[model samples]
Target: MSYEFERESLENADDRIVAGRAADGDTVAFAVLVRRYTPMMRAYARRILSGSADVDDVLQDAFITAWEQLAQLQDPGQTKSWLMRITSRKAIDRVRVSRSYTDLTEMELPAPERIAPPRQAEANAGVAALNEALLALPDAQRECWVLREFGGYTYEEIAEQLDVSVSTVRGLLARARKDIIVRMEDWR
Candidate 1:
């Protein structure tokens, strides 16, 4: 009934209102946002960092960056995806610093919802083959692939992130996709 009572009861608050409150320096609002997004953000970072122990560091840095720059977010309602974008960039930074990307072979798998147990093994083997394929790629190609596939960034965003031309990103991604398909054909 109050002008901003929902800020106190964040369970039902809209992301736009919550994010706007957070941008206005409300720590409690930010904490709610942090709690809501941490799991998804952690999972994304883990997927991107891929067997690296720097996941925590990436998440911490991402949250800090988000906290500091929340005011700059163009659309407060898109908080979830915005958080993911920040986490993706942070994960990419860690991968760059460590010069490591994916190790799908070492990754553990959860039970498939609709897949049988045998299919789980098949999926993991497929992942291993894909990992090997990715490892064989040049760094630029691998970075472009990971940024596009895992981060869901646009070609222009990736080009800006990698400091390359859009055409270069396109070329690199095309080559990477071709290589992965060629390498994975044996698995299929």
Candidate 2:
């Protein structure tokens, strides 16, 4: 299936239903969860992991980890963010555990240009630079940025997800944005 079709199908489903069923040993429901979240997870992992081919592997491991830990989850409504949290941690570990001196490549994902007008070329370049700068940031910094910008989570939500103080999240976000702006200025 095309990525767009897969993504649309997954997003259209009731996440609560999927989570509840998956929590009850419903493999199909769990598979649905995997299918629904895999693209986002892969995008996230790719950003953190760079050019490693291990993005898929990390996502798979994340799903398995989520499955095993489902029973421990107190709120089914929070499953999506919880899964994303696990995925991010797993991707971070893959980078940390790598022993070889491998030169990393730039991480890339398909853009939405084909489906929309290209009027925002300059803005797109800014976003691309921001994304690259983001990839180079510390994991905590990147996580805070993504959770705030992409996941639409508030500072409190990010702090809760990351088990950090809200002040820490605020500091991370400030550092992240300042670094991104500096790098983007260099690109201009």
Per-residue lDDT tens digits of candidate 1, residues 1-188?
A: 55367556875789998899999998888988988899989887888888578988998999999999999999999999888878877888888888896887766556647987788888888888999999999988998998789767799888877888999999999999999999999887
TM-scores of the candidates are: 0.83, 0.64
Q: In candidate 1, what residue range of length 10 has the lowest lDDT sum?
A: 2-11
lDDT of each: 0.86, 0.75
Backbone clash tally (model 1): 0
RMSD of each: 3.2, 7.1
Per-residue lDDT of 6 in model 2: 54
Q: What's the residue-level lDDT of 103 in candidate 2?
A: 27
Residue 6, candidate 2: C-alpha displacement in angstroms:
19
- Candidate 2 residue spans exceeding 4 A from truth: 1-13, 98-105, 109-153, 160-162, 179-188
lDDT of 2: 0.75
Model 2 C-alpha lDDT per residue in residues 35-94, reported as the tens digit of each score: 778888887777666657898899889988999998788888888789888976786678
